[model samples]
Target: MTEAAFIDIDWAGRPVRIEYQWIARDRAAAPLIVFLHEGLGSVAMWKDFPQRLCIATGCRGLVYSRPGYGRSTPRAAEEAWGLDFMHRQAQEVLPALLEALGIDATRDKPWLLGHSDGASIALLYAASYPQRIAGAIVLAPHILVEDLSVSSIEKVRAAYLETDLRQRLARHHDDPDSAFWGWNDIWLKPAFRHWSIEAEISAIRCPLLAVQGLDDEYGTLAQIHGIARRAAQTELFELADCGHSPHRDQPERLITAITAFIQQQPHGDKP
Candidate 1:
């Protein structure tokens, strides 16, 4: 893997330094795959999966760490993300980053590959800007708040407080508290229990591939099922014996499915 480069973008009236890297940049004309990391994830957290996937499909890949996660900006100590946090990320931060990088999504129409909260963001982006996305492949995305999801987050909070979870996250984030508490506090808020994107996602017209792990502890299969129900262009993949992080637990299968799905799309721009 290559070291990340930094770029600053104006987001929410503040300059945010984004950490990003381009994998297989030599394939300039090939389809672009933009990677969105999970809620607690960062650029380093993705390891080499994006590179491997890009190589497999012979496409260029862009991977980045969201603000407050990797070497990017950290959240203010008193800051607490709202229920609309993901929406802002999809609608504001992402577009700003793309513009800063001179990526005209309107023309390039990159494919989005996302996991967990990142997947949710991808869905939101594709829905909001249908013309900008070639397609999307999401893994273990949360479209709505479920008791199971809340419970799992609750457990993770305990682990963060008591176990080595903080240490583990520190390896990925410069300020682990920024990543953990930002995600943790929001999901655990009582008002967030009603948070749902099922209706908003109905606007997505681009092709979609929603993947989930059967044994995922964070959420149930209904997440992807609900997506497919809402978007007629959606294809579903349920992997058995896998957990919340399919990219980590089942990378080969996930990559294969994603490659096939993208390559099979109309005007998929096969290399």
Candidate 2:
């Protein structure tokens, strides 16, 4: 396992310790792709995907576990996330991490590769800070909440309460409850049904690739389709025989598609 490093940043009037690792850091001048994990994911959960993708794309990779996940600062027991959680991560947490690490977004304009909730954050970041990102490739991104998504979340919640889900997540998160509930409780909230980023994503000015799994139980094809409709820069890809986690489900194909997409960038590296 790659040794992870920690950086502390103050967010929401509290100090947060973020755990991160650099892949192929020796590629000094290569363009960077920052890897954002899924809601329940941590740098540990991402495993070798970041390294594999970076190798194929010849891009340096930054993989980090957000607050409340992995070995980072866990969420307070009483803390509950709001509808704007994703937005807060995009606007505050991400930028803070970059600044603390001395990564000047104005110069590097790194690309973002995010999964699930992280994918939504990537889209929000690209939209909110157009000049700070060169492009984004989102896997199983959710633009708006669907009944299917709520239903799946409900099931996962039950499994967390009834099954070994907690024990399983223990391998990834320092406190699985902190990772699971923070994501679950918010998504299942009644008012959360109205959560949507359709308008905000229209402001995205960077290269965008929004991908969805045809068989994703948490969402539908509408997710990427909707992004393409709202964001002119977005390109949509729907993979067959895949579920929510494409990086795990269809890594080779996903990697191939992603490499092709990034290589298409004017200054992106080629295979």
Candidate 3:
């Protein structure tokens, strides 16, 4: 079982609350797996998948909602996220959060399991601090912007404006507009069209498992394939009959793949 908790940290010179949960914390020597959610995802949105994966792999799990999502601090109405928002999360917030929780990445070398936008953040973090990560398992990561991604984002903008998407998202977020627009506006910005981490990702020295759904409307297989071309230890798994979110659509298969991947790593010895 997992239990939710909150912690306060100074971000941009102001105090901010971050919501997180831990699974299998009693296994002190077990490998750590940190869960990073998608753009619209909150801590609650992950449901029981993280707990299940932690138990299956005999690893400790840490799942958290980024700022502006779930019970964490909401994005102010006037606060427009910049093109490098995801970069900031990886370069700044993640490290800060881990430090606040007394998680010494240099010692623990946690594995990052991230989805969608979170997957992209994981890649950035691994590239920036390769030695601190044991490995990374990214699902539906974007190495570069694509026409398909832009088109899907446009459709999402339409849905949020004309449909019940806002109301639905409200169930997970304390301030739905803060979460929605913070992600939406940034992606749709014309300046963001050139956003690409392809060159930077080449610096990632840790083992990587990049998974993509064949039917993912937001991105193409090129996303994960691109990682393999640059990151030498990269493995790719393209799932059939799945969409953007594999954890929800194919939990069993995802779990099995991740378990096997982790087991293959040199430091993956069971506790």
After superposition on all C-alphas, the RMSD of every candidate to the true structure, in Å, is 0.9, 1.1, 0.8
TM-score for model 2?
A: 0.98
lDDT of 3 by residue, 115-177 (tens): 999999999999999889999999999889999999999999999999999999999999999
Please provide TM-scores, in order, for all candidate models, with all chains considered together: 0.98, 0.98, 0.98
**Model 2 lowest lDDT segment of ten:** 262-271
- lDDT agreement with native, every candidate: 0.92, 0.93, 0.93
Ranking by lDDT: 3, 2, 1
For model 1, the local distance difference test gives: 0.92
lDDT of 1 by residue, 109-136 (tens): 8999999999999999999999999999
Clashes of 1: 0
Best by lDDT: 3
In model 1, which regions exceed 4 Å deviation?
A: none
Question: What is the C-alpha local distance difference test score of candidate 3?
Answer: 0.93
Which scores higher on lDDT, 1 or 2?
A: 2
Candidate 1 residue-wise lDDT at 67: 91
